[model samples]
Structure formats: structure tokens, C-alpha cells
Target: MDELRAQLIATARAMGSAGLNKGTAGNLSVRAAAGFLITPTGMDYASLECADIPWMSLEGEARGRRRPSSEWRFHRDIYAARPEVGAVLHAHSPFAVSLACLRREIPPFHYMIARFGGTTVRCGAYALFGTQALSDAALAALEGRSACLLANHGMLVAGRDLKQALDLGIELESLCEQYWRACQLGEPVLLSAAEMAEVLEHFRHYGQQSGQQSGGKTS
Candidate 1:
């Protein structure tokens, strides 16, 4: 349990190091034997100790010295809805936010967009943060994709594990930034659905399709 807590903390700190988050603006969680260990709300990840991480049940029951993030509802909803998810990452990355503010969806401007499990990355409908409505909206956007932009909010991602979630979050911000830049010049050329369908098929075998983590993430 201690090791898992430490790993969760390490992953949170890594987000800071990579600039995926700052201060306490973002939250991360890893599935636990009982429920899950999530970064406490409004607490600086930089100063967190193992005990500072709180455990919360899928039923929304929280246990620990600190309070779970206000967004805990969605975390709980996600775990209950997606059996394969081991971790969830939420970030307010600048580029993603810029596009999100406009409720823009990341289209198949690049074939690499298939890394998210589709030809286009969806932008969820606007909902106030920390509400069940927000979770509902996020879940809808993430239906067939591992990552989605929260309209006028930020980004929500889930993975099979902590490392996968963190790495994907970084990659997502990069893609959003690239797409944002492309839009500055002119409308970016989008790939065909058939083309991206093929990429999705190839991604299934990317690296280790047999026993390796295919897609290696959860929505």
C-alpha cells in the first residue's frame, strides 16, 4: 500500500516536472485494492507525503486525513464504468485549454491522432467543474477515445496504469499544441476516416500486440 502511495506521488511530481500541471491545479489517481488513492484536493503535490494521499471508494466515500479532490465524483464514476482503468489524469494544460475554451475538437489533422483510439479527439460539453453533470459529459466524450478535451475546462485521460496515463497526458498536450499552431496558418488538412481506421488497426499491433499493452490505456 505504501509503495502504491509513493508511486502515485511520484507520478504527480513527474507531471510537475514535465509541466503537465502546476501547484494543485490537476489531480491524479491510481486504482487501489479497496477504492483508489488520489491526490488530495487543493494540496500542493510538491509537499505531499504518503499519508497525504487519500483513499476514496467508488461510492464516493473518502478516507484519510485530507479531503479527496472535488473532482472525485468523476474519478469514482470512471472506475465504476471502466473496469480496465487503473489510473486517471486531469490537467489544465495551456494549449489544450486554449482550444477547449473554443470547444474545439482535435480532428484527424494528423494520423497520429489515432493514438487516442479514433480519427478525432472529442471535446465534451461544458459543465461546471466537480459536478456529476461534468462527469457525464466527460464520459461521453471519452467513449471511444482515451483522451478528451473538457469543453472550456481542460483535459481528462485514463490509462491502464500510472505511467501510461502520465505519458499520454504529455503527448496529448503536444498534439493539442501542434494542432493549435496548424490552425493559425490555415485549416489543417484532415485525414480520411478509412485512412485513420487503418492506423487504428496498425496501432493494435504497435510494439507488443500479442501480450504487450495494446492501446495501453483506458477511456
Candidate 2:
């Protein structure tokens, strides 16, 4: 619990340092034994302490002094559905917000788009924040992907761990910014479906053989 709390706090501060968030505009959570440990609502990250974090159950009860983030619903829902997702990061990064505000899904303008699990990054339908409706939209958008843009909101990404989640969010923001810049000049040339399919195959096995290569036990 102590280590996880520290990591959650560090992740929050890291988001601010990376300019992926401002004020308390974003939230993060990691899957825990009970349910998950999430950032508290309406509190400045700078003033946050380990004790300030809230442990929320899958059924939505929070067991802590501070209330969970209003967006905790989606985090809880994601954990319930995706067992591999150890951590989730949501941020109001500038580029991602700009694209999301337009309510558009990002196509495969770059090869790295496959990192999120498909040829495009979905944009969830806009719904009121903290509502089950918004969670539903987010879940639909993330059906086969690990990252998505919350329409008129921002970015939500999941990863095997907190570090990976933070990394994915940063990379997604970078891609969004790059795509935004391309739009300034003209339509960005996107990769073809077949080309993306080919790339996706390569990505599938790229990281899976690491243990084998290191002569470590695979199971």
C-alpha cells in the first residue's frame, strides 16, 4: 500500500511536469486488491499526500477520508473489464484536448498508431463527466484499444503498469500534437489499411520474446 501510494503520487506530479495536466484537471488510478487506488477529487495534486488517496471498490464505495475523483467510475469499470490493465491515466493535455474538442477519432497518420491496438485512436462520444453514460462511451471507444480520447474532454490510456500508462499517455499527446500540426498545413497523409495491418503483425511479437531472449522462464 505504501509503495503504491507513493507511485500514484509520483505519477500525478509527473503528469504536471510533462505538461499533460494543469491544476487538478486529470486523474490516475492503479488496480489494487480491493478495487483501485485513485486520486482524490477536487484537490490540488501539489497538496496531495498518500493518505489523501482513496481506495474505491468495484461497486463504487470509497474507503478513505478524501473522495475519489469524479471520473473514478470509468477507472473502476475499466479494471472490472480488463484484467491486464494495471493502471490508467487520464489527462487534459493540450494537443489531445484540441483534437477531442473537435470530436474526431485520430486515423493512422503515423505508423505508431498501432501501439494503441489498432489503426486508429477512437474518440468516445461526449457525455456529461462522471456519469455512467460517459463511462459507457469510453468503454465502447476502448473496445480493442488501450488509449482513447474522451470527446470534448481529453485522453484516457491504460497500460500494464503506471510507468507504461504514463508513457502511453505522453506518446498519445505527442501524436495528437503532431497530427494537429499536420492539419495546419494540409491533410496529413495517412497509412493505408494493408500497411497498418502489416505493421500490427510485427508489433504483436516485438515485445513478447523478451523473456526468451534473456533466457528467463516464460511461465
Candidate 3:
């Protein structure tokens, strides 16, 4: 458990180093025995210690030296709703936030769109941060998907573990940037549903056949 806590802290700091987040504008968590361990709200990731991370129950009780991230509601909800998810990451990344501000659902303009387990990444309905409404909206947008944009806010990604979750977050933000840049040129050409379906099928078996983690391949 202590080791997991330390890894969570390292991952949180890595988010900033990877440019997926800055300041305390993101939160990360990994499933735990009692519940889940989450990064504390509004703290510098650089200074975090294992004990500073909070263990939050599915019912919302938090334990540890620090308070849980304000977005812990969605983390708890995702764990409760998605049995396969072992980690959740939310970030106010630049490109993702830019698209979220437009409330745009990313279309299948690229084959990587299927990497998220769907043809499009839905923009969740807008709600105040830290509210149950936000969690509900996110869950709806994330149906059958590993990631989604929070309308007017940022993005959320879930994975089988911390590494995968962080990788997805990075990939999602990169896609958002590509989409944004392409849109600046013109309405980007979008792939048809059948095209994305084919891509999704390919992704299902794209990675190595071993238990080794593949950064860009999920599920």
C-alpha cells in the first residue's frame, strides 16, 4: 500500500513534467484495498509524500494527512461504475481544455480515435467542479470509452493502471492538439463509422501478446 502511494505521487509529478498538467490542475488515483488512494488537492506534486495522498472510500470518506482532490467524486464514481478501471486521471491540459471550452466531441478525424474504444470522444455535459453533477456527466460521456472531455473544463481518462491512465491522458491531449490544429486549417476530414470500426478491431489485437504494458495500446 505504501509503495502504491509512492507510485501515485511519482505519477502525479510526472504529469507536470510531461506537460499534461501544471500547478495542481490535475489529479490522479489508483485503486486500493479499502477504496482508492488519490493525490491531495491543491498541493505541489514536487513536494508530495506518500502519506500526503488520501485514501478515499467509494462512499466518499477520506483518510490520510491531506484532503483528497476536489475531483475525487468522479474517481470514486468511475471505480464503482467500471470494474476494469484501476486508475483515473483528470487534467486541465491546454489542448484538451481548449476543445472542452468549445464543448466539442472529437470526431474520427484520425484512426487513433478508435484507441479510446469508440469512434468519437464525447464532451461531457458541463457541471460545476467537484459536484456530483460533474461525475454523472463524465460517467455518461465515458460510456464504452476510456476517455472524455469535460465540457468547459478539461479531460478525464481511466485505465487498468496508473501507467496506462497517464499514457491515455497524454495520447488524448496530443489528439486534441492535432484536431485543434487541423480545425484551424479547415473542418478536418473525418473517417466514416465503418472505417473507425475497422481500426477499433485492429487495435484490439495490436499489442504484444505478453503481459508487458504497451504505452499506446489499451485494452
Candidate 4:
């Protein structure tokens, strides 16, 4: 899995460089048959390497050189709860954290928010790190959606793969920034539930079409 490890390190660094995280304030994980590879605790993304990554079992036992990120519990719980999730990303992006601290949900202010497949992006209640309570809350908040903001902390996003997870993280942070800016102008204009449902349906069909095109090209 050296290639996967290398990709993880590179993607983590890219996320940080893109301002999706600061210092060592983010963690990333990708599913593996035995368990998963995750970022190490207290390691800066800019200098991360494949050797610095840690492996943890689905049961949360450490299996590699370094201790996994303190949010290992969060990642483990997510993987356990959602078998379809092949990658997880947690980041303390500025706008998302700001909204989380304010205890506000990311409303459906734009069609891009439809990627979440819900009326609004939920926020899990604050719980201490590495605790089962936080993991449980996060799972609940993420229901019917690919991502959720962690109250007073950051965000948790899951995807079918690492690239998709990274994309979701970026989209979430961008939506948060837009919401914040719109609020500054006046009362933010939010899409109604029916409108959001229509948007979500469109997204679902679009995804199907794209998948078909990709399959056709590969074949």
C-alpha cells in the first residue's frame, strides 16, 4: 500500500496548502482490507510522508509506527458505521469552524449545497475529542448526507474514495464561506425544502450520467 500512503500524504499536504486546514488541525484516512491508513498525530501536513502515516484496525487498535491522530475514534466510527465510505477527511477550515462555533447549520443557500442531499448540512453537538460520544453524535449528524460540521470543532466528510472526500471537504468549506458572506449582506436567502429536493434529484441523475459516461469511456 505504499502508493496509497504516498497519495494520502500528498493529498493531506494539498488540503493544507489550499487553506482547508491549518498547522496540524486536520486528519485523513483511507479504507484498507485490514484496516486503514491515517495521518499521525501532531504531524504537520506540509512535511508528512508515507512513513509517518499510521495504520489502525477497524476496531481502533494501532498497527503501525506512529500513533494515529487523536481523532482516530472519529474516523474509526465513521468507517464502521458506513461501509460505503472509502475515505474520510476532517478539517478545521476557517468558515466551517466559524459557523460551527456559532452553532449554525449550513443552510441550502446554493445548488452546490445539494451535494449534501439534504435541506441543510447538519452540525453534531460538541463532544470531547477521541470520545465515543463525539463519534456517535457525528454519525447521527451525518445521516442522509456525506458531510457534517463538528460543533465547536470542524467538519467530517466521507466519500467513496480519497479524491471524492477531498472534493467534498473543499465544497463544504466553500459553501460555509458563501453562507457567511451572504449573512453579512442581510438575511441569507435559503432554498426551500422543495427546491432543495429538486436540486438533490438533479444531482443524483447527473451523477448517474457521469458514471455511465465514465464506464463507457473505460470500456
* Superposition error at 95 for model 1 (Å): 0.7
Model 4 lDDT tens row, 1-219:
889999899889878877898898889999986688999999888787778888899888887788899888878888888777888999999999999999888887887887865778999999998788998999999887899999999988988889988988998999999999999999977788898778876676554553464211100
lDDT tens digits, residue span 1-219, model 2: 968998999999999999999998999999998699999999889999999998988999899989999999999999999888889999999999999999999999998998899999999999999999999999999998999999999999988889988999999999999999999999999999999999888777545655555321110
What is the Cα-based lDDT of residue 77 in candidate 1?
86
What's the lDDT for all of these models? 0.89, 0.91, 0.92, 0.85
> Candidate 2: misplaced stretches above 4 Å?
207-219
TM-score of each: 0.95, 0.95, 0.95, 0.93
lDDT of 2 at 148: 97
Candidate topping lDDT: 3
> Judged by lDDT relative to the true structure, which candidate is superior, 1 or 4?
1
User: Model 4 compared with the native: what TM-score?
Assistant: 0.93
- The count of residue-pair clashes in candidate 3 stands at 0
Residue ranges of candidate 1 with Cα displaced over 4 Å:
209-219
Put down candidate 3 lDDT per residue, 98-123, tens digits, no spaces: 99999999999999988898999999
Pairwise TM-score winner, candidates 2 and 4: 2
C-alpha root-mean-square deviation, each candidate: 1.7, 3.0, 2.2, 3.3
TM-score of 3: 0.95
Candidate 1 per-residue lDDT, tens place, 1-219, comes to: 989999999999999898788889989999998699999999998899999998998888888999999999888888898888899999999998998999999999997888888888899999999999999999999897889999999998888899989988999999999999999999999989898888888776665745765554323
